[model samples]
Target: MSDNGTNTTDATAYDYSLYYSEDTSFFTPCNELDLKAFASVFLPALYSMVFVLGFLGNGLVVCVLVKHRNQTNLTDMCLFNLAVSDLLFALTMPFYAHYSAVSRWTFGEFMCRFISGCHHTGFFSSIFFMIVMTLDRYMVIMHTHKVARYRTLRAGLTLSAFVWLLSLCVSLPLMIFTEVSGDLYGLVCIYAPDNRAWKFYNVFVTNMLGLLLPLVVMVGCYSKIIPRLVNMKTAKKHRVVKLIVSIVVVFFIFWAPFNISIFLQFMQREGHLPNECKFYRDIKLAITVTETFAYTHCCLNPIIYAFVGQKFMKRALQMLSKWVPRIHFPPSRDLSEISFRRSSVTSKSSDITSTIMM
Candidate 1:
């Protein structure tokens, strides 16, 4: 004011500007309202859909296989057990949905442990069964002559028991680690420990044992199987191979990304990476959605199996025939017979019968 030299005595107090170098953490206020709305609406809907579909799908597969008593073969028994594990897992989804919708865990500590234990149990069981299935397929196709003796009902039952025991062992950590905790938002069921080590332990164990190893086995088995399938000239064999390939493809497509995302989340949580990154958050959300879809594959299999299983379409038609009014439908020719007729200029009756049988 003195330097400006107009009226130093009555100079007004200068209004100085205050500048803030924004802290990244303080940039975005925790939008509690948005989070609550998301939890109340979208989470519940997602969980409900996954739960209902997974339960029905897995249940139907188990019922159909068990009722027919057609799952005596080791491979078939393994598939049946896989369905059972998936159904059990599906059972817990409603509880999760309820918690998410309410934005709190009204269930007690015991239930929190139980639910978490069941989730791991199902997951490990599913992985074990899938691995067994892949191994069985490999043996059946590549070493059929030598491995035929091991495909008995007794062997199947023993293997299934071992898988169950292994799964139970894997789930033991859940019983020990899972707990219910209260925060400003609500009571959250979380894995609480003194240090972050257990979180890393859980993530590594699940990613390696539950996902990576099994995936490697599946891929290895299929790689060898594909060449054998290609060389087979018979239509029936080719169809069966194609069906199995489709199942493998679907499994990989639905699960690979989900598991990868889960691994990343684990890394983020352990301070190996920053969790506040927007990209990470988006990936986490995507993983949650994708995992839900992947879980639905457990239900999708029965539909696939019904279509591809031996004589399933015929049996389904027979069942339909009982409900519908009798109408004259044209007799369906065997696909093999049609193919033989088209390929061979001189079509012998014996050739037609052989092709039909094949």
Candidate 2:
């Protein structure tokens, strides 16, 4: 058992610390030299690449969205919030990259808590916004006239604020418990509460809020939407259906493995799985690989959620042309002409605007 009566050691309990020194007394110190060496090289390089791509992509989305803030609909607002979440998430990559490469937390206690808080806040916020967007699409498509008045700019803003608040609430425990303390190695930033219950809470929150809840919501919403789209005769409906499918599939593909790995570790702690050395090493490796895939989703969000939309791409090019006068972009199609008109749906549904419907 751990010092806190948990089966998890410092590094195993939470994934924040990438490497552990073998001198730990809380558990049998497993020599992880091979894993440490691999992470030192692998994590820094991949994290740097992700930071560059995710920052640029999400940054462009923010610029375009802010420029068109007045014209934004509920969907656009959700997309904007999503971009902000990804940017927040991306900003933490460099810190973690440095931590992994050097195998220590040199940034101090404040940053350790702050970065951990930001990382979880961004994660939950991003997922929550995606859920919000999904439900928004469902309401606009399925409920139509019933939700029309409530889908206004003010409502979107209110909902966005709520999501951020909830995300912060969920992340608060992790932030409070996270500290820069001396491990067997140098100082490491980790969730190191004395109570083992907090460890369970950490994993429970991650599994339930981050994965299970979102998965259920997406599945429920999309199941209703698919059949509705199938019955519709418009080509626009067909395209919207495809985008919806892509959103759901991509999310699970990138996130499911990571969540599953966390869950398995939780189960092992609960004595539901074998707690052997090989299992420990294997699970750690799985978490590392799967987490990398999950991180890349921030980079993909711009393409999946915004760039796929013709109107968004046009606006982006227009913005680009303005910022770089030397390079010319083709004149975009007339906004009035390109705006999608949903057939046979209520006028409120038609109000969804081409800003989001790809």
Candidate 3:
């Protein structure tokens, strides 16, 4: 359990583990293998796929939102912002992919900081906007009368500004601490805290804000929404319930494992859990694998939230058709029917569903 002879060149291969404690320094080198060898091959390919899909899917969402900016409502505004956040997140993947593939930080110190900042900012902002969307849905369904005045275009802009500012603030620690430095793995970009406390702080912040808080809010909001949807006899109610369930289920499925893995690692580093070498290696591998799954959640955002919407798909296809003249797409039967309303209190439950989804 000494750093003198142990080869930790492969430790902490990506930014995901930048906050992880250097426990390799204490790990006994008995029969040690290159745990990160799998990462060098597996992660680059997965990251590349995530980057391409996230960029294209989110790019299309952005294009559609912009094309109809004048008609955007609170829901549309949230979707637009979410897509932008994912786009920002997707842009950082290639740099990380290169770092993973080669185990070097060739992007220099500034990019090291910039990309780290951008990555966390995107992550925080995406989750924050989803929280906003959930609340928006709650208000529209359960407190329709009161939400009208507050769900305006002006209100959405203000909320978006606040969320962006907050996300930047939350990510500042990683931004300020991240640097490119020479390590056993050669030059690497990492969030190198000066003390173990700072490392622990990073993990605590990510776990609380990135997963725990959002999960609570989502569960609370959807609990009210599901019963409300169930009480209604309209056919559209089923679709609304289905979409709500999908959102919550997908978010948990994609992110929970990753968060749990890192939290366990943090606990082990704190000596609260057994520190056996086999357990340590397993947890590290789990972090790498689960982090890859978590990163791909951004790619699924557009699909679950936007593309599945009948009206949104129609509009996106119409936009695509115009861009590619050879490909014909059926125009929306009645664009006016899909227009956003200033209030939904007096509207039917089905109308509320369409307004939120469309």
Candidate 4:
């Protein structure tokens, strides 16, 4: 019925009449006991931490972007959208935390669908935005003159809108297929497609659009960007390049294991991987652990940006300095360091090789 992305249907085949019923007298409970204790204790706590950190981090990122919205480059515009996606993704963690804490869905059918849609939408947007950001960097650093006209605010916003529109199309199945099922033993919200074809379609599309395509495009973009970096002499811009590279690698590090496990599980379900109790249990546990780790990416982004982006740090400091009267520095630190970037953009607006966009 499926290939990847952890839909319950992708595993063991089930007879719907037994699990789905109008009778309230009898019900089927979610039988995910192998990792029950681990899930109940670990998932809620981990999700809670991610929620707090991601929400705060992405919130600050958005604030910084808005404060400098007028001054932001194309990459910053991409990052602004990325932060928004992370914040939205973080918003879904609490619902999942609750789902894990109690081992059930108490929020009703409507929310079951809503949360799933939001979760997948956030995933699609995050990776797609990263790909877009990478392409922007590649163009800005490698093909400056040719891509100059498309590096402006209106162009960036237009491209962003298209990515979201495509993301929406990819994520629409979640809202349509997700459902709250099982008995009062505890309701479970999951991908519950009415048919096997739909199940296969969902998994296939999700993997291709959500993971594989973005990864391929990003790898290609970096192939070009890295060589340009090697030849560059600018000390300050190296930090920006490093930051972007670190974010890409970290993001893949977090998400790859979970997605790989899902793919393996699909293979097993389709008789490709060895089907045994031990292997099945291992895959299930791997998914639980990797999924937890993957969620941390949302929380780690701002830390990476702050650590590597000097200009961003300077701006962040400027923002904080406005609020903290006791922490005083020379007022000249604000726009003087940033004005050079604006001036550079104007003269070399067509020549990306002349100056790197911060």
Worst 10 residues of 2 by lDDT: 1-10
- Choose 1 or 2, whichever is better by TM-score: 2
Per-model TM-score on C-alpha atoms: 0.77, 0.90, 0.90, 0.82
What's the residue-level lDDT of 73 in candidate 1? 62
In model 3, which runs have C-alpha deviations exceeding 4 angstroms? Answer: 1-21, 30-33, 330-347
Candidate 2: segments with Cα more than 4 A from true spot: 1-15, 21-29, 328-331, 338-358
Looking at candidate 1, what is the lDDT of residue 18?
4
Candidate 2: deviation at residue 56, Å?
0.6
Q: What is candidate 3's CA lDDT for residue 277?
A: 89
Considering TM-score, where higher is better, how would the candidates rank from best to worst? 3, 2, 4, 1
Prediction 1 TM-score vs. true = 0.77
RMSD of each: 14.1, 3.4, 3.8, 6.2
Q: If ranked by lDDT, best first, what sequence of candidates would result?
A: 3, 2, 4, 1
The sequence of per-residue lDDT tens digits that candidate 1 reaches over residues 1-358 is 0122111110000000000001123123323354355546866687788788888777766665675565356656877798888887788888877876776678888888888778778877987888888787777666757887877998989999999999998777655666665544556566544455655666666678866788789789878866765565545556656666776778778777767776765555445775465744454456546666666766676665553554434444444455554854333445455655554423332222221122
Residue 102 lDDT, candidate 4, scale 0-100: 76
Return the lDDT, model 4, position 113.
72
Report, for all candidates in order, the number of backbone clashes.
0, 0, 0, 0
lDDT scores in order: 0.61, 0.79, 0.80, 0.68
lDDT of 2 by residue, 1-358 (tens): 1233221333433335846532233224466878888888888888888899999999999999999988888888899999999999999999999998998789988998899999989989999998898888788778877988998888988999999999999989888888776655677787766687887888888888888888899999889988877775544666777887888889889989988987886676567887577786787788777888889999999999999887888999999998999999888776565335434453333344232373
Clash pairs (backbone) in predicted model 2: none
Model 4: residues >4 Å from true position, as ranges? 1-8, 11-34, 183-185, 237-241, 305-307, 324-357
